[model samples]
Target chain A: MYLAKIKVTYKPSVLDPQGEVIKSALHRLDYETVEQVIQGKYFEVRLSADSLAAANGLVESMTEALLINQNTETYNYTVEEVEA
Target chain B: MYLAKIKVTYKPSVLDPQGEVIKSALHRLDYETVEQVIQGKYFEVRLSADSLAAANGLVESMTEALLINQNTETYNYTVEEVEA
Candidate 1:
């Protein structure tokens, strides 16, 4: 089996209002040292694949096709082989 | 400076309906090899602190206090010191 850990985040140019709100909340809570916060989605996917290459391809395709909005968000993932 | 990469996920006993939906969607899309999917929240926090220990402590406290609900979710984070 292969386990893929994927993180989807906004492009640097994008304005993350939720992140901004969270940062403001932190500051209100007295975490004055906090400089920035970027909030994203994480997914753990377990799948059977013939090889690491196949696993990576599956994850890449799946993420790009369904998990993210190409115009507003981007994703990166790491696929690791695991015992089934 | 310190950067904290945090992942918040539901406890093992908790049911994740969103994950189930995603898994079903993937199956419909012909990702039949997919076995399981777990969806989660990821946060990247940048903060300034006096030392590495302080940074870790700050991340821990802020996460526990604001970012996660203790009843259903748990979080893990990696803290790295970065050039200021």
Candidate 2:
């Protein structure tokens, strides 16, 4: 089995309202050091694949399909082997 | 200034309770294909530093100090130059 970790984030040009809210909250909570806050989605999948290459192919297809919307967001992933 | 995108996620071995809740929610929403929903924090920092190396240094320090709890969570980052 293999483990795939994916991260999805909005494009830099887009405005992140969720992040803005969190930034304000942090400021209110006295976290003045926090200059900005951007929120993104994280996914960890346990693949049934036999090898790293297979796992990567599965993850890449998933990312390109329903996992992310390429129009407004971008994503990247890393894969590792799982020890049984 | 450089743009630093940092992603923080829980260690794979640890069970993610938040992800469980989201997974259940997705199932209820009829999104059965959604196998898991692990959530993580993302930060988009606009550094005051002049170069990518300096920005990386700042980001590393920030990650080590407060952005990530190394004991339970791990983080990775990518830096890019912002065109003027």
Candidate 3:
């Protein structure tokens, strides 16, 4: 089986109020050193594929088509094989 | 600088309607081979820390206090040193 961990985040130019709120919450918790908290989406995708290359191709296509908003968000992923 | 990528997902016992919807959409797009799509939250955290150990400590505490709801969600993270 193939497991894909996909992350989609707002582009740098986009405003992320959720992220800002989380950052503020962290600040309130006395985490003064940390900054720029951007909140996005995480997709845990599992599929049966012949190979890593095949899984990557299908996942990349999925991201472009539905998993991400191309105009406002940027995405990246990692593909791994796990024992089913 | 320290960079932390954190993922928070609903526990297996919880319902994930968002993930189910996405999976159905993918199925409509003829992605029959793929299955079990679970969607969650992704956090990109940046901070200035003296060491990776310190960053991990603060970040972990942040996760417990604010990031993930321990009752229904499971969380994991990766911390790295990044160039500012």
- Interface-residue RMSD per candidate? 0.4, 4.7, 1.0
TM-score of chain A of each: 0.97, 0.92, 0.91
Clashing pairs in 1: none
Clashes of each: 0, 0, 0
Q: What tens digits encode model 1's per-residue C-alpha lDDT throughout A10-58?
A: 9999999888888999999999999999999999999999999999999
Clashing pairs in 3: none
Cα shift from native, residue B37, model 3 (Å): 0.4
- The residue ranges of model 3 lying beyond 4 angstroms of the native Cα positions read none
What is the Cα-based TM-score of model 2?
0.57
Per-residue alpha-carbon lDDT of candidate 3 for residues A1-84, written as tens digits (9 for 90 to 100):
999999999999999999999899888888988778999999989988889999999999988999999999999999999988
Could you tell me the lDDT of residue A80 within candidate 3?
Answer: 97
The better-scoring model by TM-score among 1 and 2 is: 1
Candidate with better DockQ, 2 vs 3 = 3
For model 1, state the Cα shift of residue A20 in Å: 0.5
What share of the reference contacts survives in each candidate? 0.88, 0.34, 0.95
lDDT of 2 by residue, B1-84 (tens): 577788788888877898787567556654454455576777776645656787787678766766678888988899887753
**Residue lDDT tens for model 1, B25-70:** 9999999999999999999999999999999999999999899998
At residue A80, what lDDT does model 2 achieve? 88
| Candidate closest to the true structure, highest TM-score | 1
